[model samples]
Target: VVVVVVIVVIVVVVGVVVVIVVVLGSNGGNVVVVVVVVVIEVVLVIVVVILLQVVL
Candidate 1:
């Protein structure tokens, strides 16, 4: 049950970040900024998953 909740949260966060990236990309935002944001988000998701695994 905890694992399912964590997965759902991660999916939602990734989906939102992807949507933001698409919108910013369309608006001519910097490619470097987009890449950095994506990288940070991915790292966050991985960290959260790992922590949850240890806890549960």
Candidate 2:
């Protein structure tokens, strides 16, 4: 459980950094894309947590 949580945290951190870089590189032009990406990421994380709970 601890290992899974640590991995998830690391992935989320990397994803956030990538998203930030993308948004800044686009100069705010892709605001909609960014929102969609964020929503997708959140959903994926939720799904993973749910699966983990079920399995554990």
Candidate 3:
């Protein structure tokens, strides 16, 4: 459905944004911890956002 597609797009966009923001802090352009943090943050944010959308 359109709702599912919207959520998927939002998640992908957030992931890309997180990666871009994090690459700024990596001198070697690669940091395991930063990658993990970005993933978790993105997942959490997306879940919370979706939940809020459903509740309202």
- Candidate with the greatest TM-score versus the true structure: 2
Go through the candidates in order and give each one's C-alpha lDDT.
0.70, 0.79, 0.71
The better candidate by lDDT, 1 or 2, is 2
TM-score of each: 0.53, 0.61, 0.49
1-56 in candidate 1: lDDT tens per residue?
A: 56766776877677677767676666556565667766776776787778778878
Write model 2 residue lDDT over 1-56, tens digit each, in one string.
Answer: 77777877887787788788887788656777678778877977997789798988
Highest-scoring model, lDDT: 2
Question: Higher TM-score: candidate 1 or 2?
Answer: 2
Q: Supply every candidate's count of residue pairs whose N, Cα or C atoms clash at under 3 angstroms.
A: 0, 0, 0
Model 1 Cα RMSD, 1 decimal: 4.1
lDDT of 1 at 51: 77
Q: Return the lDDT, model 2, position 3.
A: 78
What is the Cα-based lDDT of residue 49 in candidate 1? 79
Which of 1 and 3 is ahead in lDDT?
A: 3
